[model samples]
Target: MSQRILHHPVLGSLEERHSVQFEFNGSVYTAYEGETIAGALLAAGVRTLRVHEETGSPRGIYCNIGHCYECRVHVDGVPTVRACMTLVQEGMRVTAGSVLPTPLKKGGHAN
Candidate 1:
């Protein structure tokens, strides 16, 4: 089942929109034009957007708006993109963010 809101209390019903194809982590998925990347992924039942940069813990959408960057992902070879703020485009490529290496001190110890 899709997670999309088909009917809104105030907006009534959903309007027909063009469908677009996008790739997420090597898997192809369909999204509606003008829809945010995070929205499409959520509708497709994708909860985990990325892993924590430091701890390698699963991170998903915390804020639908652009304030919280928990939904950050790689889009079109670009890194650290806010999926909630980015619109889904045809042929777009989205990848989950990976764990980043910790910074090292001059003494070769992790900072």
Candidate 2:
């Protein structure tokens, strides 16, 4: 049930490419070479890349062009890498962003 676009009206058919394996949240998934992380994940039916830091709501790709930070995910232990901008690589480790503890105020309440 891949959502890959095999043919585009203007771009025509997709070129043949090798497949690569990457880990996402401890699960291994296959992705086509030269494809973006976001693209591959979406093709695999993975919509929620991460959750909102504060609200704990689901978050996924918003702007495929990388303008919006909604598609941000951890790649190879690095934090805040935009999934739409980063290309998928073999053996790469990707993890969904998680909520971090909020900064506390003078007493003990979160800011």
Q: Each candidate: what lDDT? A: 0.94, 0.92
lDDT tens digits, residue span 1-111, model 2: 788889999999988989999999999999998899999999999999999986789999998998989998999989999999999999999999998766764468644
For candidate 1, the per-residue lDDT at 53 reads 91
Q: Which portions of model 1 show Cα errors greater than 4 Å?
A: 105-111
Q: Compute the lDDT for candidate 1.
A: 0.94
- In model 1, the clashing pairs are none
How would you encode candidate 1's per-residue C-alpha lDDT over 1-111 as one tens digit per residue? 678998999999999999999999999989999999999999999999999998899999997999989999999999999999999999999999999887874469644
RMSD of each: 2.6, 2.8
Name the TM-score of candidate 1.
0.89
Q: What is model 1's C-alpha RMSD?
A: 2.6
Stretches of candidate 2 above 4 Å error? Answer: 105-111
For every model in order, what is the number of clashing pairs?
0, 0
TM-score computed on alpha carbons, candidate 2: 0.87
Count of backbone collisions in candidate 2: 0
Highest TM-score: give the candidate number.
1
